[model samples]
Target: MDKRVTYCTDLEKSVIMSNFERRGWIQVGPEDEWNFYWSFTQNCRNIFSIDNGYRMNDNQIINHFPNHYEISRKDLLVKNIKRYRKELEKEGNPLAEKMEVVLPSGQVATRYVHLDIIPVTYVLPADYNMFVEEYRKSPQSTWIMKPCGKSQGTGIFLINKLSKLKKWSREAKIPFHPQLSSKESYVISRYIDNPLLIGGKKFDLRLYLLVTSFRPLKAYLFKHGFCRFCTVKYDTSVTELDNMYVHLTNVSVQRHGVEYNSLHGGKMSVQNFRLYLEGTRGRSVTEKLFADMHWLIVHSLKAVAPVMANDRHCFECYGYDIIIDNTLKPWLVEVNASPSLQSTTHNDRILKYKLIDNIISVVVPPDGIPDARWNKIPSVEALGDFEVLIDEELMEKEENGCRPTKNSRYR
Candidate 1:
């Protein structure tokens, strides 16, 4: 049997197994902890998809792209965008609103640190101080810091201070924030204290949105994605939300909760949440959340439109994380390019499988559909024509640092 790779942790692997009989795909199992063995063949071609470990779709997105690769990751969400553009408006940028926060008072706090440099594709420091500053100025400064390269909320830390970061780094005897010369820390963003209400608890909405086209950009929300419940009251008192033990936006983490195994007792899926939102909460609030989510994607895409492909097969999909405030106001949290395909529960598997299935169905078309898959399609124009003169190494340095390229010298 021909085989292609799908990688996930053990917990998620078991969940993926549930879909094998229904999705028409065989689960080649009995593998290592994270190895997902599967017989996958496309066009009679015996191609293999190997995910050595967690790196999101960075490898997949690049390996499939012929030669011209782009750099529009966390690097583009730098502090300088504030100076270039007023307010946290998403005119079409991918990381808008989520990375940029407009407080209830209208103060714009960006998750970026340096307003001067953006790493396009090279390695650089990921800044958290900008987020620190934004937090300090906000009515609710408590925030979450994330490593740019982590997914499944693996490296997310709910922190409360600059001193705590330094002290913790010192305890580890490793460089984190203050020791910036060698720190591999995350881009700190002001954490939202007011998570949207769900059954009187804090929860985040995970909308599965895809950017089918970057140029003349096209976007749409998945019919179903799901919500993440923190299993605790919505409190930003540091002592409360500080516990990643309880306040994670990841289903992988929450599903592992002591109560997850109970009968719909732990978390709620998108189906239930939508129904609840429409009935109990009213459709107006539900529509408001989607409206805000659409607004964020539409504008964020516009900001980065200058540096992507417009071909039918070339696409960049995003798993957007959003939190709605008490007043039913939606605030974007972060955008995951390669969201965790690793489902933690039966419901999780069902939603993500359908989402991934739709993605593959669109990208990997069967016979008559014509390979309209984004990566399989050719670029609308030559890469050289639209390519910018950005420095690869320097760009990587800044982007890896999680700072946007603000210094025009590199551009």
Candidate 2:
């Protein structure tokens, strides 16, 4: 029987379904009838989802193809910066040394470091009171609160006063409803008071990352992502603390602003941002900044590669949000597992449409179905704007008497 691909009911109207249709891949009905399944939920047979583990995806690649290939058995969904920071703190990791923080008590802290690439984030309930005490010491500093699993700026707020957090926590407390009560936790991080501003507005980068394999750790970075900007100019004054339009760069938050531009969508391409940086910061500085971003991504994946459960049938395209500080440093804000693909502007439509298309080009084989018997990396022609960061198979080849071709620069 010819293998066909099927997606979950939720994705019936999603852009990915259309991308698959464009590729001429036969889409089967939701009758649990297909050789390949594209789903957001884990544990479906022959599936591609965010999670992979014993019960998660049955460690299917290992159980099904033990002799064929070895898969790394770890969880790669990097949603929690707190846990991610812990992983990077292992002895000898170079990022560990660069992200040190001094506590109010005069002790040095490196447990939450990511090479000056992240704000000092602490998981709540456990670190809640300590964070409150820290805030007490630095009343003038601002901190942002983010729920562990929520995204799109949901359940996010800024806390400038310790008393407000205490009152809010008290109001959120419930006796029996554990799920509804203060039992719900958050991560609070020191806000970057000074972000690199464009046109007097705060903005962030939404870069695309495609990970095809984990055991071999094959990953790619799409070069065509754009910078999302706030509709209002950034303001750090106490009076503007509640103005999400000035503080947050989320499209959901900014779209409500009166000045939100529907034509340009209050966003610009990363390439244009790069050009602007080059014009202002010089080419060498701009080049180093981009290189540093690339380095941050490659090492971030490397930190979690060992624990990710690899499934050949599964591939994930992550949206990595990054912020550039005033000193020309790129700080990783967060990573989204299911980034919104909806486009709100002409440029957005063009970029996202091509992003999905390019993702299809890189992932799907020429035959419309991945050959279960073999694994092959995408060629440069199929990569579109995606650049491969690392390919374990290629590394293995070089280890076993293969010399890199002149085109190795692209690899």
Candidate 3:
């Protein structure tokens, strides 16, 4: 029997196509029989939709889960995380321990310390009154408003005053009805004004995580994730509020700025970032920061695992955007279902190409064939630059010291 993997992809990007070509995978149309499909998030929805009535065999696999928005959508992510924390608190988990947090107005508030990775956020206009209440408590605090469905720092702006929100709503012709279900919904989060700066400029980390399953979640973190730097220096003056170049570290937004550099594409390697942190801050503190980041990433996935579809044929590579404050606290900015395949520089191209190659290796079985029924765990040789983030099944086995019986079905 022919064992060459037949693949299909809706994307025309070189990073993805080249990887497929390098593996000698035959290209097939979406409607044709194929073992693998690299699909867009929208295409995934269509493929998995009940109306489409599409079914996959054990030999087929694809990227993205049916309900990935559980942790990808800005609003849903916050809702799921809040729900996860509450459930943990109800179970009396020490991980959900509450701690006192000081507000910008010098007032103190108690919050779940472990899950406090994300900033104080409220989805609007449903939470309009709640946002107002929180805003009044810290009248001087700056909050960033982002469209729930958008990406790449689009439709994002900072507001330090209530009037700015009102003016924005009015000018954008957005209805303030509490029952509104329009796609124009936004999430307003407290801005981390005092971000950790490198070379006097602000940047955000872009970490890639690959999830093979949701229930008994299996995940891997890519080691070569990079940091996207803002083209301009960090500034907190109210006058500079509209300067996206000063606040947004998204390469798409930064590339439009006059200070954008083509040579380096305004990016820094995460290794260099760690070195700088360890050198500037103490090594222990820097280590703790990275540890905390990993903890939050795992918990964030756990938060939405209950809601994820967890289809056997689906696996997703997510881009997690994170920002670290001046105090070395890493904040969960957002998660992307489909990270950009577009490389901005030569190094970036190589990194992303390797990323795609590693993803294929880990997802495909040892035979180099896509098989959804195969155990999700890949051999150490397949992991390339990716490190195992979590394997709940392996954790369970280690904790119990029990091996599966012959009759037991492998997950």
Candidate 4:
């Protein structure tokens, strides 16, 4: 039997630990020698964190870790969206042509990028003035303002007028409050207005993405994700604009809704959503739509793969939120590094429980020991609901004349 200690600190992460113990893996204290270590914050000595942001010391220690997961850097993720228009413009990818937007320089930007997937976002303080000029062109357009580092629907609001920003700027002064400092400055993006509605409500997809390696860029998209529905019906009327329950699909915000369902948890299974779309849009169209979503995800990972400081021992499961428009095109909203594992309802508990279990199965060996160097492509059966997007080991196997079986499951 394999014998290697695994460590995790967050009590809320006990779901993961419970499964680890069930697998007969020994759990060790912080000071003990361990093969797998999980924490919320990165440790230089030998640790992995759920967070993506890191310090220089963390990077320096990263190289020495026999196995370590790279923390998702928030600044880097912000930059990915902020500079996406520019980068895709330079590359001239066809995807860019789809996201057409006229630059302030009068340069027509073709890259509707993800259409409604990613709201046209600009990094504030740096891009604030530029966005202001763009907004002046259409002051009636609604925009969502969000703080870079905060989560759980915190520091988010919608604005349809430029005067509010101007007023905030005037009061806070040009320097902006340290609370709203450039690092913490709000990422203001054009709000997605006409979302694909179900029962006349706005909703977004919360899909899980697991990354076992970054350099090789192996990822998996969970098929059994869910849709977060806003409790209030979506409306564009001026009076309803500030109603977060109508505008936001975040469960954290939706729970406060008087109409929120305790049984359904304001969520629907992704399978059910797929079935609904298939019934309405036809099978071929639905399949292609999901395939396109997969495409967007792979490329997004590629965009940040180079800058990701990866360690062999590290693995991460990201919560990716995507929104679809009336045209059935999926838009990238945001990627959450540490998605809440809390189970607010029975359905939520079951899905999250299975999610943690499957993740453990994919990353940990049968003997309960983690072999960081065993970096082979995971079998689909081991992945449960997830499908591999990019696997370097698979490529290596193919190059060496070892093709996977015809019945092999990979998407």
Listed per candidate, the RMSD to the true structure in angstroms reads 11.8, 5.9, 3.4, 5.3
All candidates: TM-score: 0.60, 0.81, 0.96, 0.83
Query: How do the residues 121-220 of candidate 1 rate in per-residue lDDT, one tens digit apiece?
Result: 1122344444444445653445565665556777677666667766766775656335456545355555555556665667777776655455444444
Question: Highest lDDT among the candidates is held by which one?
Answer: 3
Backbone clashes in model 1? 38
Off by over 4 Å in 3: 402-411
Model 3, position 278, has a per-residue lDDT of 82
Q: Candidate 1: which stretches are off by over 4 Å? A: 1-140, 172-180, 262-267, 309-313, 364-411
Clashing pairs in 3: none
lDDT comparing candidate 2 with the true structure:
0.68
Q: Clash totals for all models, in order?
A: 38, 4, 0, 19
The model with the greater TM-score, 1 or 3, is: 3
lDDT of 4 by residue, 243-264 (tens): 9999899999999889999898
lDDT of 3 by residue, 80-101 (tens): 9999999989999888899888
Model 4, which residues run further than 4 Å from truth? 1-4, 42-75, 81-109, 112-117, 171-183, 396-411
Error of 3 at 102 (Å): 2.7
lDDT of each: 0.49, 0.68, 0.91, 0.70
lDDT of 2 by residue, 1-411 (tens): 964454333455346677767656666654544444444432343333234322223111111221111111111132333355555566555555454566655655554334455666665666655776667666777898887656789978998887777776767662222234355567678898899999999999999998877677778889898899999888999999988999899998899899998999888999999999999989999998888787677666665666565656567777888898898888777766667878798777777778878876777666555544446577788899888777777877875777764224323
Candidate 3: C-alpha lDDT: 0.91
